[model samples]
Target: MKKEYMAFLCIVAFLCIAALLLTGCARTPEADIVTRKNTEALTDKAAGGTENRKSLAENRKQTPEHYSWKYNNDAETLQISADADILLPECEAVPMYRLSSGGFTQEQVTGLYDYLFQGRETYRVEEGGLTKSECEKQIVRLRKQLEELEQQEQGDGQGDDDWFPDDEREYLQGILDERLAMYGDLPEVSQDKKIAVDSTLMEQTGIDEREDGRTYEETTHSLECQTDEGDSLYVESGSVDTSEFSLLSYQRPGRYTYSSGIAVPVDPGNADEKKSENLPCTYQDARALADGAVQAAGITAEITQVELLEGLAENGEDGVSSERSGMYSAFQFQYTRTFEGISVATTASEYVNEEEFSLMWPYEKLRIVVSEVGIQEMEWEAPVSVVETVEKDVPVLSFADAAAVFEELTPLSYEGKIEKLSQGETDASMDIHVDAVRLELMRVKNDGSKREGLYVPAWVFYGTESSTVYTSDSGSAEETWSETEPTPWIVLAVNAVDGTVIDQVEGY
Candidate 1:
């Protein structure tokens, strides 16, 4: 009895341990199923948490490895086949959604596609590249699908009638019309040719010329006969009936016409001779020729210097014994010509008689002199000791005659300025400061009045202040003063007769 009881207890302990082990294995599988469901739910949430979520196993089975994300370096190209299911990051969705390659941006591709597929029945893809055409074809197919979807949506009362704006639809319709017009069938060529030239020629040439000639009974013929072994003879003849030789039936032979003249040879030697005769010659030809011929030559010319005498001897107001000295006076000039050449030097004076001074050459150096009283009174004159002489070529004419020729070549008008003017107050001291007024020559007019134009030389004192401040009854007066300290003055050139200011020089 005791032994049976011990075996039963051991059996009960083994059953208990087996039951606990079974319960533990069942709980582990339930926990594993719950954890797997939670993980799947988390993965779906990561993939946008939509009903269209595809697991990794499903994605691997549906899409090929080549259709997955790939990076390319060579050719700088990125290609995505139709089978591709690329999923970009949310941040890159906008920029990375389009494909680009071969200098064609995504915008251009989209524009081309939009032009191809989004319009009316008039629109059709005439011809295009493989990729663009394929894209257009896909868009057309998608549009058909969209139409079916729209039908279903309308049936379900979910149709979106605002899919395309009015402006966009009109633009697309216009584009379709333009494309259809551009690709319309070509027109057929007309077969008239005024109608047919060949047919007309055949109709004109249908009659035989020989038959036509035979109708007139005037067909000319030639025949020849010869013996078996003897010399042969030949004869030729032609005949025409008077009825067949109508004036309207005769035709004139064509003649060729050409230009009426032939090209003549040019005589270059004659042309050169003509050109040489027409060439211009210089005025100094005689002088150039004589320069080589003459062995020696001398020249003599004279220049006059006029000055205001400051102090000179003069008769007093009493006109007799009440004499005075150092008074202003005038003087006379004496000229002498000197002959200097390879031969000798001879002096001659204008005051001498022609017969006495005949030995002296016509062209000789001349000296001038003035009275001592005049020299002392002249403002510009110093003590008269000696004068510098200038040599010039002597023409075959006299000095006065040459001067006349020069005057004919040069203008003979003088221009002066009314430099200073002083208002004369009654009994007011009239000790006016005299300034050196400059003068210049200007163009002459029809009227006898002179026109004075002035230009002051660079770096010269124009005038004193007292000379510039004077008021006078001139027509128009202008004064220019320098801006620097101790300003220089410039008085404009004015007409003395009419008092018109002709030209002015601005002070620097």
Candidate 2:
């Protein structure tokens, strides 16, 4: 009886414990809703992770770690793949001649003389007292008109015989003559020495024919001259086309047509003779040639440094290229206009493989293409010196601050097919490498006029902005996959300066 009672109590305790467990296991409606919400949140997270697989590198601003930000140190350079397929049509480069005794043609002399003189004409306008003189003349004419009107009224009744009124007519005519005598004539400036030298040049003019059928008539002309005040000015130019060959083709946007690839705006004529002999001369020789041209033209600019374009790089190159078997045919010289040994800022000067210029092309320049023989040709801007120049303060932006400007995202666009890089990147959007930073002096003209410019200091930077183009497309905005590299189009001179951009082509 005692054992049965103990078993019943144990059974009751077990049943109560089981009942408590069942109560704990049971779920309310709120609990079930919370579980469902947690599961949906996890599903949303997974969907977001699946949506964003590929990311764009350009979305973030990039700064170069490899380049020195100082000009005195190593500068960064970029390899720019040129769309050589495009060429400038109807564009002719000025031919450079060996500074000979022969002088400029009559037309050349007259044109330059008039050009500079015309520039000074405005200067004399204010000084000549012409405005006051005109006012006095206008008053005198008014008096004469009134006198004539009174005489006509008096003669209205009289016949033709009395119409003259000789005494009144004579008095009025005398007054008019006196007024005319008071008016001073406009001023004229003469540089007799320059004109005398020009006459000598004209006497020595001649024409020569190249081995090719082309004939380049070279006549010495003063590209620059000086006045009594010692200001350097371009007062003369020659009627000469000293190039050894004629242009066979031209390249531009959309299409490029050339007679021969060799004529690729490189050395136009054949250079068979120099191929055997040590082809390339020294940089010293190149510098001498440039100085000679400047001296011949009477320009005041002195080239401080003459750097050779690298065969493979932009900043600097490994020793000199092989003279005979190099990619270039001649020594190209770039002259950045200077004043008193200080460098002047030029906008459209790209002196690389060859000197070229164009309003249509983004970065055009005036360059001299020289060979072993001498200066082959020149392409330059018609730059004129200011009669008066003003100085401005240096830019407020610091070097590092200017560098930080690149950290901001900017849009880059390109035309035509691009080069294919081993690393797959669409060069359509460009990434620039900050190579060299410089705080240098530069000049900008006022009111878009080539004359009366201002000299100011700016932080100039040089670098390569790279880009890639696509031959085809794949994937949507959210998801993308590409196994093959896309075509790339890139142009450097992501220039490359500071201060106000006065013109389209801004370079240091």
Candidate 3:
């Protein structure tokens, strides 16, 4: 019995210890359980809170067609509606607080109207509401107002830098004043009389046309007319009295008729006379005749000044040959005339020793002076050929041959220093000088296959102390040579397929 009792006690103690250990492992802390339960409750409340509440009014408002909602104060409910054809009832104007229900507020309605109807021509006001003249006047007024506002914005203390300079502003004002003065006035200037001289008629007056129908060669007289204003006009009205002037024909030393049908007369006696005569005009006889004709025509003209211009020799003193030889002469005569308080100057030039002996006189300049009452004088240097020579050794090249050679040799990439020392042509050959040349070749492959080649020609120039290289590629490669050296370098050719180099030459 004692043994049984001891064993039983040991078992009981072991069972008790086991129970305590299990209880200790299975039980959670009170504080942790409270924390977990509280958290779960808060999450539940949050999930079911105000955010989950949906009203019919709000739902209707979310639809685009309905797109409207209103709060009813009397009914304490929100109402909403939507449909494609539905129209909201228009609200009467009311205080902000009173508009707590129905339709939109004034501001909201205005915004809606603006959003829907802005920039659309469907809503037009009225036609002919403003006349064009009234509109223009309003525009001018608005512009003036805008200008004033701008001036005010710039401030009074600002300088006149914003406006035109004084001289320009004054000029503009004067122009405006002149324009205003012309508003109701006749044109201030008269149209100019442009008389086109008939060259055929004028040619009939020349000594060469004496055999023509007109008997200008048989009479020698002058006519004068007096204008109503007491102005006198003189005209050469008489014929050339050829019967009194007998032909004293004498052969001249230098006289010759050219194949061009021009007759040039040179008499030894006349040559001595010409030598004795002052450089340009042999006598004042021509001027006297002109004056007499003017007096006969009743045109008031006074000779104010006369000048003699020298002639240029057909060949230079050394007689060097040139292309310009015998083309023109340098001798001329200038005369100034005053008429109707206007001073006009004119020049008459004679081309002598040329195949064609030509004479040119200025009549337009004289007319302009007479009309404008202003002194107008013009002087020009006549071009004369002093030398006559043919260049014997000048080189010439055909365009096609030059282009072909340029295309062929330009592709060869030569390696060396290049200096353009000289370029010249001889009668037979053209000469080109280059100091150095360089060329490089590059092989390129595409898609793991060698399809194209690249050529680069580079040149170093001694004159410019620079170097340049040109690249040429396959398919699209072209060869070009240029006299002007490239800086750094330029791509001369590009390959269309496989992008391979064809030719490249560099120059320095």
Candidate 4:
């Protein structure tokens, strides 16, 4: 009887276990449905009219549906929403800030050092160490001489500081003599020329899969443009691009054209895509190379200044050349312009500042790539025809008064740009500041509607804006402040004679 009773209890226990298993939650699909519905409702309640919706509204306010850049104020995050149809899964974020460059920096230093010390192919060394770039060397020598003079009491014949006692003598004895051969008398001031381009058929560079092993690489680009009055222009250059073409300043109906280019590999062998070995060329070498190329293309506009502008280099990695820099340290020699033989500005001697020149001359220029293969790729643009007209000379306002006038004219808000270099400190802020102001006396041309453009005297102001450094781990970013040119923030022209503003492509 005891054994039977125990067996009966065991059977009851097994039946209960079977019943629970049959009615378990795993067998009920409705439970999952219920949980999913509850989760969906909870998620909607949390996000709707809350974090996500509110943020989207704010982002739309800052950036419209038409624009790409969006900012989330609360999170302090910014994003650039690309085209809805396009996809760039490999693309990385780009930093919001890059240091602004303006005053004498790396370009000037490197160019000057190389030009003075290193010799070039066609740049012959004279008996007295004089080369084609003698003017530059002379300026260096003059600066040293000036320093020696500053240490002494008088500009007497007893010491080596007897060259110039005054500005006129200094100009005649040192500067004039050294510059006579290169630029006879007063150097030609650049005349204004304008070209209008409506970029059609722009094929943006997508993610490219270039060969990783590149001892040398070459690229090509086709120039396409049409004038504002309806004229078609097309040309091609050797390299893909050094800089994406942008209309820096435009005066309508100007003549602009370019020449075809050639490129050679630095090394035909090595089968290596290692590093962007510095192109074995000094500043003097660069100058000579640029000169030969420009001359070969029949470009006569003189090179007033040479700058080593940092440009995009091909990485032996997976990225487009248009947007990112790679292992190779790429550079371009940008030659700023002045109308070589015909540049004229009738102004007081004190106001003639040559160092701060380009802000005024919105004219001709040249850009060529410097590589181990030699200087083959070049971009040249200048005036086809300029009809000069004489205008009655009028007296102009002082520099102080001119600055005041410019301030009154421009409606600038120091919003996001860095403050101008400290009037006192070394660090610069992210906000825009106007620290330095300079004036250039220019002979602006009237090249728009009429046949004769005015040979009018104009006062051009150049202001330097401060820069903020970006060290984020974004697209091709570094840990330190980048060595960039000082920012030339303002370019405004005030009529020297009548106090009227010349309305060209205004502002920096």
Q: Could you tally the backbone clashes for each prediction? A: 12, 14, 55, 19
Please report, as a residue range, the 10-residue window in candidate 4 with the lowest summed lDDT. Answer: 93-102
Model 1 per-residue lDDT at 177: 54
lDDT of 1 by residue, 398-457 (tens): 112212221221111100111112234111111111122222111111111111111111
lDDT of 2 by residue, 186-234 (tens): 3233212233222122222567565555555554433333334322233
Question: Which sections of candidate 2 miss by over 4 Å?
Answer: 1-280, 300-327, 346-365, 392-396, 409-427, 443-453, 473-503, 506-508
Highest TM-score model number: 2
Candidate 3 ranges beyond 4 A from true positions: 1-283, 290-298, 313-333, 340-363, 366-508
Q: Which ten residues in a row have the lowest lDDT in candidate 1?
A: 376-385
Question: Could you give candidate 3's per-residue lDDT for residues 441-464 as a string of tens digits?
Answer: 111111111111111111111111
What is the RMSD of candidate 1? Answer: 63.1
Cα lDDT of model 4 by residue, 1-508, tens digit: 3454344345434543454466654332111111101212322232223211122123223322221211122322211111211111111210111111111122322342233223221111123333345455566666666666555435454454544446634754566466545544332433333443232222333342333432233233333443333323343222112122112111112111111111112221221233244545554555576665544434344442233332343333333334323233322444432232222221111121122211222333346654454543444332223222221122233333333444433322221122233223333333222332322324333322111133333444433323344444435544435322232223345543334455442211
Worst 10 residues of 3 by lDDT: 93-102
RMSD each, Å: 63.1, 30.3, 50.9, 30.7
